[model samples]
Target chain A: MLNRIRCLLIKELTQIRRDPRLFGILIMAPIIQLVVMGFATNTDIREIALAIRDNDRSFHSREYIRALAASGYFRVAALPGPVAGDARQLVAGRAGLVLVIPPGFGRQLVRRAPATVQALVDGADSNFGMQGVNYLNQATRLFSARFAREVAVDARLRGLALPAVAAETRVWYNPELTSRYYMVPALMGVLLLVTTMLVSSMALVKEREEGTMEQLIVTPLRPMEIILGKLLPFVVIGFAEVTLALPLMRLIFGVPLRGSVLLLYALSGVFLLTTLGLGLFVSTLVRTQQQAMLIAAFFVMMPFILLSGFIFPVENMPPAFQVVAQFIPLKYYLTIIRGIFLKGVGWHALWRDGLILLAWGVGILSLAALKFHKRLD
Target chain B: MLARAGLAPALPLVTPAPRVWFNPELESARFLVPGLIGMLLMISSVVATALSIVREKERETIEQLMVSPLRSEELVLGKTLPYLLIGLATMALILLLGWQLFGVVVRGSWLLLGLATVLFLFAGLGLGVLISALTRSQQVAFQVAIIASLLPAIILSGLIFPIRNMPLPIQGLSLLVAPRYFIEILRGVILKDTAFVELWPNFAALLALGAAYNLLAAHKMKQGL
Candidate 1:
């Protein structure tokens, strides 16, 4: 049985080697995608086009505007006039944030009276709008703390705590909160899933389409051996992709892999099992490579990409959709990758994710083998 | 959650009054519908046309058609016209669904929107034909078509992430992607009520891209034959 499997594996590998175009694409596409998408996936809101309508022309108002500009979050472009119309135009055109400091905004702050500043945000993109609001709040609190200290020194009131309570935020794990650090790791999962599924889903169908299945059936190999042999090459290809991508993650993207490399490979082994089984299952259902590719893309790849929490957070999804996401293998892989890459947690924290992935892999591979065996019979 | 936990005590100190402009209610469907329209047109046109051509090749009918008196351009058009109609029909269906299910009414000129949709479909169909001609195998064509169309439409087209926030190089790279312009036209026409005077640049870009793809595919078809 081992000899038969090896002979089949050698045949599969040799055939793959003959198709240099497909082999080259299978290797190069992921690396290029990772680098390109690494630069594109930024969630950190910075350099928001901010149009300021400073009605209170006092020194303090200018100071506030200067402070906002200095925070590196907002590019303060002063509007031609302080009218609501001007601010609205800017927000509509290109500016994401518009700040209107009302009249007497400085005197109220000096006297410790409540001051209201109106912020009109272009909420077409709600995520950016929310992040912009939070950044503004942080900058305002920082400015207010400095103002309170100055007021205490000038007023000769040393012991009194200021009336305003300030909140300080310390972002853990991702201190700079760069999205690439988070997204680059997730890109690995996306790349592996797409490439592996594309390759393996086409595996059996290609044989059937080319009329080679009859020749293979005449060999001494059993159905199980043929299935394993067909899948083994893609598993190797998947691992090769991971090996190629991990260094790109570490060297090119500068993402640190703090967890044991052995553990990551082990988990990746399980993930490859799940994705390849899905591809093999897809192969069994289709007679043509075109059908296999389409079904694998729409039914397998699309749902996995959407619900994997790669782009959209699963928590923010509707409750029913969130429950649906739990069935996706990419969802669990994302948790493991992010935990291992960002938080550097060990198997102690991530063992459950590992176990679920293992169960999924075994269950899916068995189902695929069963289906393929039944098809052969 | 932690940010809110920290801010819970400081809620009384400062009240931030935020008003959203253009989309006052912040309806996601208003934004998602236009992008979805662009995506649907792309998948249906590109994948369908590409697969149709590749299927003919796989079944050994393409050589017979090639040996016929039909010019390569006529052959390309003959193959793509059905998928083009299918693409337009799918676009109309999706637009109708968007209006009915999501309340995303077309605020700008329907003529402009229709023109943009045709131009977008032309580019996508041209790309599909191009992929079909470049690769021999239906599997490779299908994989290439999906990878080429879907990822860029979703990620690089400002459908999910704001293009302005992307790195300058990636932002520049987005200009090469056809759906980026279509998404702009869709959102501008459907949600923002943008006039044609303001949308001429996107129209011109789509036209140029569509012409370029079709011309290249026509050229490649000639070369392949």
Candidate 2:
């Protein structure tokens, strides 16, 4: 049985050795893809258009005006002349953000009366517009805090009334709030799912097309043995790929892994099993390589990317999509990788993820095994 | 119908074209270079290798090849090298075009990129061989190759979505996919100007993956022996 497996493995290697183009793809595609992606995917959004309607010509209002301009998140495309009606034109023109400082001369501040500043934000592109609103709000809040401090100090230096309680705002996960830190880790999950499904599914289809599968079927080797022999090479290869990927990210992209390496690999094992099983199952269903490739690509790649919380948070996804995302092995795997790499959480925190992966692995493997048997029948 | 007085064709109305918006220097990368590399690799490994093996089985050429003095290694290399070299040449052509047409800079060290490419080639070749081992037909091999190529290179390598924000389990899964490492090395060398010390672990992983995969291929290639 061992010799049979070895013989099959050797035959496979010989075919690869003879194919130069495949060898090149394994080597060159990554570099080309990276170059294209690095240039195309930029998180830092620049050159936003903003319209401002200033109702008061007071020094305070002017100061606020200056603050908005200095924030660099917006470009003052137009300034309305006294009327809110003129401001409406800019918004209609699809200006991304609008600032309207209401008419309240310096008298309101002197009397300690409240003042309101209105900001109309565009939510057309949710990701971009939402981030813009957050930035605008932060800038406005800082300006208010500084102004309050100055007023209190001038009113009374030593005996200034201290607030009863101060609220401290702390952002979780990403403190600097750089998008890449969050994005790069999430991308890893997407990439893993892609490679696994593509490799495993295609492997089976290729075998069936080649007629070597017929020979193998006629041979003494069992279907289970054939599947294992096929799966082991990819699993071993995939593991090596991930090991290489980690430090490259650390050194080049500055992504840090704060968790135990062993734990990460262990979890990956379960995840790979699931993906490998999925690919094998796909292979069994389709007779032609092209059909298998298309099926795997469409069914696996698109949904896995959109719903796996790779780009948008699963929490933020519509409940229906969220429920559907649960079935994607990547959804579970993404949480595990991020938790280990960033939060450094172990089994105490990650057992759920591990269980899901194990369940997926077992489920997919059984399905694949059954499918293999069906093909024989 | 034209002879009838009422049959004169109405003159076509002239319409103005839609007003164009300002296009702000949107630099787009022509994916042909990478696309070609991916396409050729997929074809050679999954399509070509599978077809050849299937044909051999159908024609009873397998018996002749097995009995020949050529070792399994020689047979595999002989069969696989043509495709491998073609893939490499295609890669070089695409790289040249990418630079000339798109101004895509190769920021990483050339030596490191070359070494990483070699390792990645080994892995791809190994994977193709492994796929060939498991199947009896070209269709099965091609399907497997597509599955392997699509995911790891496209998503897991930080090519499309940033890897950082991915929930934890997916990240763990990516660690095992080889293309993720190759993409790292490629990106590290080309975009980040990464050094060898930084690229070594990825290279090591590729080497290990390639070695292990090839070993399995070697074992499977001599199946009847």
Candidate 3:
């Protein structure tokens, strides 16, 4: 059985190589996607374009604007003249935020009275809008503290900057919060899924579509041997992609690999079992390559990409969405990949993820192996 | 908490009163519907066309076609035109559904939307043809088609994630993605009521990409035949 499986693997490899176009695409698509996603999957939303409508035209109004700008979270994109507070800037997609200062704004501040400024936010991207608000509040607090000291006498005596309790955020493990560092590692799991699942499924369906699958079934090979033979090439291909992507992600994106390289590769081997199993399972369900591609793209790829915490964190997802995300094998693998790459944690810290992944790999592979075997009989 | 700290006289400096524009309620459906329209059009047209030629190759029907009286251009045109029409029909149905279900009104110029849709579909068909010419299998064609349409549309395009937030190089790379232009046009027309002047560049970009892909597909088909 091992000998037949090895022969089948060789044949599969030769056929894959014969089509240079397909081979090149299979090898390169994942790396290209990883690079693109690495650059694009930035959750750290900085440099929000803000349009300031200064009606008071006072030093204090300018001070508030200056404070907001100084926060490094917002960029002063435009200074529209105060009129009707028309959010054309926000509407035009030029700015995500608009700060409107009323006429009594500076006067209220001089008297140490509470003054209000209207912040017209493009709430279209609601999460981004919320972040902008959070940043706005933080900047206001910092500015209010200084203003309270100079403008309002007896700072602590009168309720001012001191909120009694404050939340100080000290970022640990990838403190720079370089989104690329976090995203690049997670991309390993994502790219692996796309390449392995699609290629293995398509390759299997192609054989069946071309009538070669029946030829294999007639041979001395066992059902398990044929299934293993069909999928093992994708296992090699998956690892090849991860290996290619990792060094590039490290050197170019500067995603430091602090964890053991051997551990990363070992865990990746475990990850492939699940992906390859999924690929095999998808192949068994579809007759045509069209059906296989559709199912793999929609059923397998879509959920993994969206909810696997590849771009959006699983924690941030709605509770219902989070529950759905939990079932994706990639989610656990993603945590392992990121933790190993960024935090340099070993299985001691990541045993839960490793066990989950191992369980997923074995469970999925066995079920798929059995299903493929039954289909032949 | 400020009072509890015993820090009296909490001086409020410029409280922010929030205002929203367009779909002021910030309905995600309004944003998502336009993007979904572009994505559906992309998948249907591009995948339809992408699979058109490759299936023949896989099934060994190309030799029969080559022997027939039909020229390669006619075969390409005949294969792709139905998809274009179907894509438009799908777009209209989705638009009507969006309007009825989500109250996603077309606030911009209809002429521009119609014009943009045709050009976008043309570009998609051209891409599908190009992908068909490139690959030898239905699976490969579908994979290439998805990468071409969906991934870029979701990530590179300002559909879910704002494109402005991407790094500079990726933002530059986004200029090459055809769906980005289409989605930009969709949001411009559906939500912003943006004038043709503002959206002219997006239109121009779509046309250029469409023309480029068509020319490339023509060259590839000639070679393929």
Candidate 4:
């Protein structure tokens, strides 16, 4: 059985070698994808082109503009006038943010009248735009807080005091809040899903389509051996891809490799097995390569991405969806990968995740083999 | 027997209750816009390449085409044109949906958006042809094509994650991936409204990638399996 598996692996290698194009796609494509995703995934947005229409020529209004500039959030552009409509153009032009401080001539502060600063933000790209909005809101509040502190003795500012205690945010794992810091490790799970499922699904359906599965049914190899023989190469390929990606992440992407490499590998092995098992199950359900690819891409890949807590934290998801995410192998792998990469965590942190992955691997693969055996008989 | 029949639907009750759906438009916008473009490129390129390749193989006209006076470059362009057109149409449909349904405005000029869409379609179709040339049968070609089209382009590209967060090595690696460049180009032109000067590098990269892939595909075709 081991010899036959080796033979099948060699056949796959031969096919890969014979097609340089496909070989490049399989081996070189991920390397390129990693580079592209690295450069583009920036959560720390800078160079916010902000236009301030200062209607009030007062020192207080000037103070706000100075404060905005001092906060490192906005680069102030020349404004012809301060109007809500004018700020809309700045946002529409992708300037990212626009601040309109209304005309009170510093009278509101002296008289204790309620003053307002209107922030118009571009909502087209919500992630960055929302971040920009939050930064802007915080900056404006800081300025107001400082202003309130200065006038506390005047009795005019007593009722309009800002919150006494400021909420200090210290982002623990990703200090820089770089999207790559968050995205790259999670992406390892996604890449594994793509490579493993693509290969196994296509290989199985190709056999069925070519009438080779019938011959396999007549052999004494047993259903488990056949499934294992067909899928083991892809699991190895998935491992190879991940192995290549890790160093690339460490050396090139500047994502620190802190944990035991051996543990990371061991956990990834179990996770890859689970992924391969899922792919085999998908192959059994689909009769053709087209159906296999679609089912795997849509049902498997999409859910894994949405539920993996890669982009949005699972805690932020509805309680029910969070529960559903537990069924996904990628969710566990995401935790293991992120924990190892960011927190430098060990077996103590990831034992349950490892167990879950092992269970999934054994259960899914066993069910798939049993179904294949029953079908053959 | 009646009791067993009544228990048939209840057997599914053995599993825990399913999760309820909370439909949020704001949540959908972040992934949906880029996904629409990426999915369009994938669906059009795979179907077009599969149909065209199957036609050539079934008619046995590939050998005749190889011997014809027309250059392989011309033939590839002819084969790819329909897919490229369909992809552009798909782009238009998605853009319309984004605007009408999702309220995503095209911040950049429509002309630039059109140009970017065409280039992206060109790269996607070229990739489809390359996959088509490599596979033995249409089924395998379609499978490979979908794999190539759907995964890396949608997720690996900067569409979802900002590229800076990828490990430095992966960041460098992404320079060669065609869709990563194209997605940036699309977003720059559409969402960011960046001008030609700002977008020139990405456009050049995509065009270079398209040229390189098409040339390799043509060479492979000439040296038939």
lDDT of each: 0.80, 0.63, 0.79, 0.68
Displacement of residue A371 (Cα, Å) in model 2 is: 1.8
Higher-DockQ candidate of 1 and 2: 1
Query: What are the per-model DockQ values?
Result: 0.32, 0.02, 0.42, 0.07
Give i-RMS (Å) per prediction: 6.2, 22.5, 3.9, 19.8
Q: Which ten residues in a row have the lowest lDDT in candidate 3 chain A?
A: A157-166
* Per-residue alpha-carbon lDDT of candidate 3 for residues B1-225, written as tens digits (9 for 90 to 100): 635555455465556777766667776667777877876677667767887778988899988887888776677777778888888888889899999988989998888889999999988898888888878778678778877876776677776667787878889988988778888888877888877777789999999998888778777777766
Cα shift from native, residue A156, model 1 (Å)? 3.9
- Candidate 4 structure quality by residue, lDDT tens digits, A1-377: 78876666676678667756555656566666565555555556655677776777788888778877888867776467435466345423436566666677467765644476665565555665566666777776777667555545443233333223556666576545556676787776776776676667666666786678887677667777788777766666777888899888877678887888999889888987888888888888877665776677668876777777866689887799999998988889999998898889999989999999999999998988887777787
Docking class of 3: acceptable
lDDT of 1 by residue, A339-374 (tens): 988888999998999898889888887888888778
**How high is each candidate's TM-score?**
0.87, 0.57, 0.84, 0.70
In the range A1-377, model 3's lDDT, one tens digit per residue, is 67888899899888888877777888898788878877786666778888888888888888888888898888885475545645567666777888778898888888878887788887666657777777777787788767765644555445454433435666575523576688778877877887788777776678888999888888998877887888777778888987898889877788889898888888899899888888888888888887877677768887788789887779977799899998999998999999989899997988888888889988887887788788788
TM-score of chain A of 4: 0.83
Error of 4 at A291 (Å): 4.5
* Better model by lDDT: candidate 2 vs candidate 3: 3
Output candidate 4 Cα RMSD: 13.1
Top candidate, metric lDDT: 1
In model 1, which runs have C-alpha deviations exceeding 4 angstroms? A53-64, A80-92, A100-117, A137-154, A157-178, B1-17, B25-30, B95-106
Tens-digit lDDT string for candidate 2 (A240-342) = 6577567666775677788999998999889999989999998999987657765776677666776788766799866998899899889889899888877
Candidate 3 Cα errors over 4 Å, as ranges: A58-70, A77-85, A107-114, A140-146, A152-178, A258-260, A315-323, A348-377, B1-12, B22-44, B63-74, B85-118, B137-143, B188-197
Q: Going through the candidates in order, state the TM-score of chain A alone for each one.
A: 0.87, 0.79, 0.86, 0.83
TM-score ranking from best to worst?
1, 3, 4, 2
